[model samples]
Target: MKKSLELLEFLGEPVSRDMKETLAHGSRQFRMSVHMTRVPSINNVVLYSHWHEELELLFLAKGSALFHIGQEKVTVRSGEVVFIPPNLLHSASRLDQEEIVFYAVLVHFNFLSSLENDQIQQQYILPIFMQNRRYPKLITREMDEELHIYPLLEEIRDAYQQESLGYELLVKAKLLEILYRLQKCAIHADADLDIGESRNSNSLQAKKVLAYVQQNYGKRITLADMAQHVNLSPAYFCRFMKKQFDLSPMDFLNEYRIAEAISLMETTDKKMTEIAELTGFCNVNRFTETFKNFYGCTPAYYRKAIRNHAGDGQHAVRCDTDLKSY
Candidate 1:
């Protein structure tokens, strides 16, 4: 039996307080899970740079986004899927004003190789799993017609949404099918594997800067402090951040702080003042003012709404959705 019911975590709740994803997606027996991530129109930074040790499959369920993965950027449209290999620094921003909604399936390679099934693992899984082979970054409906990729992704979504018995097996089967098709596609596809040195350097710098923000967001952190920590002058840092993230350094800091505060509101019973202080606001009024600026609602109202409708929010409109422990 595949016992895969873990905490249902959406992107609103950061897996950890840091830049890196720290949530355990699934149980130890089966290291895979799915999440519905939503980005509101007012969100300045749709997502902060974060990396985890799991292979991620992202299905654009509703709207489009400008996805920054490592050094390269991909504009992913609705009804598309993006394959993100493990340990890649990635972020997203709304392409237009509409909110971006997507479902992310986080899986570990060990789950595929865990059962040994050695021949397939050695021949097919190892190279791609090790990032030795090139793979397609974007898959469209055309690829689905040709390779049936989208159908499998839909099956994964259906399995996760319904969460019936044997859903784990269903998800695993679809993921393995997708991986096999990806390997074959790479063998014949003229995909570019060279992500470039500039991209690699940018990814490192992004990680460093974002991690610094995560570590020190509770304390008063200045632009000069962040720039100096990353060894770039304040002016250079501002330009770099604007070019890379499409947001000013100060705006990004506030966005990140608000995201953390949102998580606290969703997961904890802390008072608004305590939450604000914990997230680095000078006072409760300041926190509420900024929160309204970012989310378009008072902290108290937002907290009440999220708490009241969390089980049936935009992310969980389906009745069979297993939002256990949400």
Candidate 2:
């Protein structure tokens, strides 16, 4: 029997608090999360650019969106799947419609190799984790439709939703199949692999700057400080950051701070003034204006909406959902 959409959880919350380092996937046992998400409009950007340790598979079920991966931007239309390796910075924005729907499956590589000396770990997992092999970043239905990867994704989704007896075992088997197929495809498409070597130096520098920001977002940080941290001139750093993240250094900093403020608002009961000070905003007015601009609501209103929705037993705001105990 086909499960109704209402039975599938819809996750549209903001980015995770530790998104700069790793996305918390809401459980330690399974180390995976599956979500069906909807973006109501092009202006509604669901998640900011962030990176994590989990491998991500995103399937575009409807509409179109621009996916920014490192220095590249690709338009992911319906029926396409994008594969993101662990710890790569990426984000998505609506392209041409009032709404876009997508399904995401995030899995820690360790989940696929439960035993320390598992054969899968030796053959498939270690190469990618040890940086000895590379995989393609995006897989379009137009190109890979004949490959049957999309069908496997559908199977995984249905099995996850159905939650039949031994569903975890079924999901693990499907995930292994997907990984094997991806490895085969990557081997055949070696020339087209979007490997990390191309952006090795830049990625390191971006990580450095991001780390500095993560540690010092509460303090007044200057462009010169960040540039010096990355050993680039301010002008060069600006261009490099723009090329890497499609946002200026200051813009990225503000966005990061805003993300932190949103986390504070959702999880803590701190006053707006305190939240502002803690998130590095100068005053309540500036914080309110910036919050409204990014989230389309004042801090107070956003809090109220969250509170009202909190009592609803059917749904909860979560960065990631674990399917092991569902």
lDDT of candidate 1 over 177-204, digit per residue (tens): 8887786577521243454445557767
For residues 74-166, write the lDDT of model 2, one tens digit per residue: 888888898877777787766674467678888887777646777768778876655456667778876676556777877887787677889
Sliding window of 10 residues with minimal summed lDDT for model 2: 314-323
Please provide TM-scores, in order, for all candidate models, with all chains considered together. Answer: 0.72, 0.72
Score candidate 1 by lDDT: 0.73
Q: After superposition, how far is residue 243 of candidate 1 from its true place, in Å?
A: 3.9
Best by lDDT: 1
lDDT for 257 in candidate 1 is 90
Clash pairs detected, candidate 1: none
What do the candidate models score in CA lDDT, each in turn? 0.73, 0.71
Residue ranges of candidate 1 with Cα displaced over 4 Å = 1-13, 16-18, 35-48, 63-66, 72-78, 93-101, 114-124, 157-173, 183-198, 265-275, 283-289, 296-326
